[model samples]
Target: MNKTNRKKFYDSQTWKSCRKLVLKRDNYLCQLSIKQNKLTPADIVHHIEHFEDNPSRALDMDNLLSVCSSCHNKEHPEKGRKKDKRRMKSRRMMI
Candidate 1:
């Protein structure tokens, strides 16, 4: 899907619901971080297969994983987006 369509899909209620379900399934913990034995909270529902490359599986539970933003960045460094220092802290973050 194109960037516009991808954004629209991500912004949809369906995606939001799916994301919540995945996070719940993963216990809101970062699945990637768990691989490293860390205990970070996940705030994103990431596609195991790139959503753009596998749009057909975008909403498939088996295709999703709960991930922290840092892990998500490592998974897709090609995006090259910088972390915004001014972003609000998550309530779930222990600090």
Candidate 2:
């Protein structure tokens, strides 16, 4: 889907309801935090399998994860990783 359509889907009532359900199911706690022996409130309901890659499972509860912004970033690092690579290249060129 295009960016516009993807944004619309996220803004839709269905997505909203699903997000709420995931949060409730996870008890509003960041799932990653539990592994580290910490409790953190989740601010996002992230797709375990990225929505773009597997749109069919977009609404699957088992495919959703309640996560904080930090954990979400770690899970989906493509964008950040690219930026980091660019910065590293620039630093190397300067050295």
Candidate 3:
């Protein structure tokens, strides 16, 4: 596994709420690869960290990025947010 361990920042409801705050902070613009591309708000909120399991960093506005779906999918090729969440949740159950 990647030792980078990005999931360490999403642990509580705080992360979800923080995500909303960050989205509003960025004006719904994708922080990643959005400087030139013209896209709509239908994009995704790309988390700076691949894994979001740590609350402290999860709510950090700096750690969140408002990205469109295309950019978000490009960043994470195989796993979607919903799938990732489910996988992460199941993994937690085993631990």
RMSD of each: 7.6, 2.3, 10.7
For candidate 3, write residues 1-95 as lDDT tens digits.
23443444344566667777878888877766557766567356665764434534545677778888777787777657688789999999999
Q: Which stretches of candidate 1 lie over 4 Å from their true place?
A: 81-95
Q: Between candidates 1 and 3, which one is better according to lDDT?
A: 1
Candidate 1, residue 62: the lDDT equals 99
Local lDDT at 76 for model 1? 86
Cα-based lDDT at residue 20, candidate 2? 98
- Between candidates 1 and 3, the one scoring higher on TM-score is 1
Look at candidate 3 and tell me the lDDT of residue 93: 100
Q: For each candidate, what TM-score against the reference?
A: 0.81, 0.85, 0.56
User: Which model is ahead, 1 or 2, in terms of lDDT?
Assistant: 2
Question: What overall lDDT, based on C-alpha atoms, would model 3 receive against the true structure?
Answer: 0.67
Q: What ranking of all candidate models by TM-score puts the best one first? A: 2, 1, 3
lDDT values for all models: 0.90, 0.94, 0.67
List, residue by residue over 3-46, the lDDT tens digit for candidate 2: 99799989999999999999999999999988999999999999
Q: Mind sharing the TM-score for model 3?
A: 0.56
Q: Model 2: clashing residue pairs?
A: none
- Which sections of candidate 2 miss by over 4 Å? 84-95
